[model samples]
Target: MVDPRRFKSRSAVNAYGGLGIGQSVTNWHVVGRSRASRRGQRAVKRVLFLAGRAAIRGDNALARRYANRLKSGWEDRKAIRDVARRILFVACAMWIRKEVYRDELVSVPSPTR
Candidate 1:
């Protein structure tokens, strides 16, 4: 596992340019229908995206988040990107605390929509 501290900031983990988490809402653009951008770490982004998909296929907080996003009318890629971003944050937190991931740490309520 990669050391979270090495990232220094959440933006580093997300790697969508030097933009912070708030800026990510506008700055982060996943290149799905075009050539890949040379900005962020493509390999890391790919891994996170895949992890999000795997999480959605299982019973976990990430899956719940994915479901909620979908229920809220988010597009598939958008919801998956949201999950990937969340997974990055959670992974960083766990790595920094030197603790294993516990689904209980995240409380995703059942989707009402």
Candidate 2:
């Protein structure tokens, strides 16, 4: 499952609906229809979006702070996407390195200056 696509970088994971996490409309030029097909797996995108939602609602303070920090400038859904992107990045790193997930090791810089 990890190397099936042989992703070259963390950004590749966003192809799984990472770009459209909080977007109601992906295409801006074509209002009614699109001239081209959209990329990425829709199922994975939904799953990732759900995971973002869960991250904010769950009891993980780190995840909460991460999402909250983003909220200062972004909409709630956008913040969720940021969290989802982080999730994808971390998942990719852990999978590539074969490392176990340790929440304590994942740190977030304070939002305040």
Candidate 3:
């Protein structure tokens, strides 16, 4: 039995699809098309890698904020993952809100060390 009402964040859904969560979606076709275009695939991979690196640094506020959350449990790996998850959530929410990623709102971080 599957819960159709279940809500998953955009990235989570994408990841699930990428991981073969349930039935196959047309995502593979999309990915194949993306990869077929060598330039597009390279650009995408570069962007993803850059974003990942930025998250590890102090420049990305979203990552910093999520790091604070993980501080409660003192698990760096889990914290970084949570931050990545939130980043995807924010991207999805922004798309739904028909707006761009506002650095001002998401940039502010806690005054903790």
Candidate 4:
């Protein structure tokens, strides 16, 4: 198990040079756009990205959340980022509780007006 206290919050994780939150678009033209940002911890970011992709490929709360976000018209990268953030929070919680990850614990709420 890991130390949950190592990360104070989701934003802390993102600021630690792990998540790709630092990335930003450099230019946007009528025909095309360019993106650029400060380099984060490549290894951590890659692992997180892969984990998010894997979660999306499986039948779990994260996967359902990703699909829901996509259906709601969220951009692909934005959806992926949110997934990764969720993963970080879940991991921290699991570590703190000394329990295994559970789908039911991460339930996706039904859409309501």
Question: Judged by lDDT, which candidate is best?
Answer: 1
Predicted candidate 2 versus true structure: per-residue lDDT over 67-90, tens digit per residue:
557746656665666676667766
Between the candidate structures 1 and 3, which one is better when assessed by TM-score?
Answer: 1
TM-score of 2: 0.65
For residues 2-95, write the lDDT of model 4, one tens digit per residue: 3557867767766554554343334652333434224656676667778898999998999998888888777888788778767877887787
List where candidate 4 sits over 4 angstroms from the true fold: 20-40, 107-113
- Better structure of 1 and 2 per lDDT: 1
lDDT of 3 by residue, 12-59 (tens): 433532311233238554322221112223443344445544776766
Best of the candidates, TM-score: 4
Better TM-score candidate (1, 4): 4
Candidate 4: residue pairs that collide: none
Per-model CA lDDT versus the true structure: 0.72, 0.62, 0.48, 0.71
By TM-score: ranked, best first: 4, 1, 2, 3
